[model samples]
Target chain A: MKNLFLIGLCIATASASSMLAQDFSAGSTAKSWNLYPEKKAFFKAKVVDPLCTLTGSCPDNCSSGKRQLALLRLSDNVMVLPLKNSQAAFTGAANELQPFCGKDVEVDGLLIEDPELFARNLYQLQKIRIIGDTKWTKANRWTKDWRAANPDAKGKGAWFRRDPRVKAAIAKDGYTGLGLETDEAFIKEWFE
Target chain B: MFKTSILSCATAALAAFAGPLFASENGERITITGEAIDTWCYYSGVMGGPDAVVGAAHHTCALWCSAGGIPVGLLADDGTVYMVLKIEDDDHSNGGDTQMTIASHVITADGMLYKRDGINYLVVSKIIADLGITNLNHEDYGPVPSFAIPAPKP
Candidate 1:
C-alpha cells in the first residue's frame, strides 16, 4: 500500500508538470511556434548597426528623452520595430528606419493580441512574443543605394558590405541560438 | 524547457484580412468573425473598417522571424467563420500579385484561437475602399456596419 501511494503521488506530480510545461512540437497547436525551414538553406545577412538617436542623452529627466525607432528590410520585405514602447511615434521612427534595413532571418516569435505595460515602465509589452533564434551568415554582396531610396536623408546609409571579421561577430552575438529552449524544440524536430 | 525570459514578454498586435471594409446602413464597424481551421488555434476576429485596414495592412502582420504566406480563416466578433485561405497579406498589396508575400493568424476547427503573445487583436481597413464605396476593387460589395467610425468619409 505504501509503495502504491508513492507511485500515485509521482504520477500526479509528473502530470501537473506536463500541463504547465510549454510544448514546441512541430504540429502542436500551442500558443508559440518558431521558424522551421521547409528546406534547409543557408540564410545570409548584413551586419548593420541598430541605429537610434538618443534625445537628451546627457540631460533632464528620462521622461523628457526620446528614442526614434529602428527599421530594416530583408530582401523586398520591410520591417519596423519600435525602439521603445510608443505607438504614436511609431510612424515617424519607421520613416527614419528605412535606411537601416537588414536581411530576413529564420527565427520564431510569440505574437500578442494587444500591447501591455508591466512594472510601470516605458518598455511596454507587444502583442507578439519574441521567441526562437536563427543563424545569420554575412552578406558578401550588397549593391542597393540608399541615396536613391531616401533622397532627403542627409547621411549615407549603412555600408552595403562589411569586413569578414564583423560578420562573424554578429553571428556570434547579435542573435540568440535556435535551439536548447522549448520554444525552438520545433526547429530540431523539423530535421528529424 | 522554453524559459520565457523576464524581459522578453509577449504582447498582441493587429492582423486582419487584406481587403476593404466599409460601414453598413446601420452605421457600425463591420465585425468579421470565423474559425481558422488547421492552425495553432481556432477562434478569430476582425474589427475596424476601411481606415483601420489602410493603416494595418502588410505593416500590421510583421512577425519577428515568420517567412510570410500562411493560411487564414477570417471571422468577426460574433464567431462567424469567413473563408479558408492559404494566404493573408496584412501588408497593402494586390491579391493575385505573385511578387507579394502573405501571412495569416491561423485558427483551429473547434473554436480555439492561436493566441499571438497573450492577446487577441483585430485589423480593420478603411471604409472607402473596403465597402467599395467608390468601386475600388470592382467586386459586388455588401452593406458593412460601422460603429467604430461614424459616417465613412475620406
Candidate 2:
C-alpha cells in the first residue's frame, strides 16, 4: 500500500514538473550521451528557436493555442524542446529568426543524438536536467483574492497608481486618460 | 462585469516579463533611437524565428521543442531565407531594433519606405534576399551565408 502511494506521488510530481514553466540551465553542453539521465546537469543557454514553419489561415495564425511549439534539429537528428505558457510573445519569435537563411546556429538542449522523428513529427525526448541559477519568480497579479488582502487602498489609490501613463496622455491630449490602466479599453476593441 | 485596458494591461505585462532585463530595470520601452539592423534572433539554424522561437504563436506550441526535437518538416530552397519582420516608428527611443513593422519599414532594399492602405503593411519578409541586409552591412543581426537550402523545384 505504501509503495503504491509512493508511485502515485511520483506520477503527480512528474505531471506538475511538466506543467510548470521552467528556464533552461545556462553554461552547459551535451557533455555525454546516455539514453537516460545520470544526473541533472545545470543547463543554460540564450533561448533560440525551434525548427518548424508555422502555417496559419488568419492574421494571427490559428486561434487555437498549442503547448508543444515546434521541433529543432541541430545536426542530422539533434534537437531540443522549448515551450511557453502563453501565446503572446511568439509574434516576435517569428521575426527574430528571419535572417539565418535556414541555417546558422548552435543549439543547446539535452542533446538527443540522431533520434528519429516520430509519427507525430517529433523526436522522442529523453529526460534531461536543466540548471537555472535565477529562477523567475511569479509576478503578482491583482485578483479578488488580492483585494481581500488590501481593502482600504483598493479604491482611488489603486486606480491612480495603475495609470501613471494616463498622465502622459492627459498632458498630450489635454484630456484625462481614464477608464483603466493596462488593456481595459484596448482588449475590448480587439476582443470584446 | 470587468474592465481591462490594453495599454495599462500590456504595460504591466511588459513590466512583469520584459522588465529588469530587456529595456530597462523598470521594463520601460527602450527605443535605441539608432538602428542596429536587429530582429529577433532565431536560435535554430533553419526556418528563421517562426519555427524556433517559443511563444510567438502559442507559447507552449513554440516551446514544444524546448524539451527537444520535433521535426519541423521545412526544407528550404536555394534562395536567401528571410524572416518576417515589423518596423517600429522612430518616435520611440531606447528602442529595441527588432524587425520593423510594414508601416515603419521605410528603408527598403531600394531605400523606399512602404506606405499603403493609410495603415502601412510594408516590411518585406525576405529583406536579406530582397533588400540585401546582408552581413556586410548588418553588424548586429546579419544574414546567414550557408544554409539547408532545398533545390528549387523544376
Best-matching candidate per TM-score: 1
Model 2, B94-149: lDDT tens per residue?
11223212111122321112211111112222233221111111112121221111
Per-residue lDDT over B35-123 for candidate 1, one digit per residue giving the tens place of the 0 to 100 score: 22211122111222222221112111211101111112243334333322112322211111111112222222222121111222222
Scoring only chain A, what TM-score does candidate 2 earn? 0.25
Q: What is the DockQ of each candidate?
A: 0.01, 0.02
List candidate 1 stretches off by more than 4 Å.
A23-108, A111-192, B1-70, B73-151
TM-score (C-alpha, index-matched) for candidate 2 = 0.19
The TM-score between candidate 1 and the true structure equals 0.21
Kindly list the interface RMSD, in angstroms, of each predicted candidate in the order they appear.
Answer: 23.0, 24.6
What DockQ would you assign to candidate 2? 0.02
Which regions of candidate 2 fall more than 4 Å away from where they truly are? A28-96, A107-192, B1-154
Number of the predicted model whose lDDT against the real structure is largest = 2
What DockQ score does model 1 reach against the true complex? 0.01
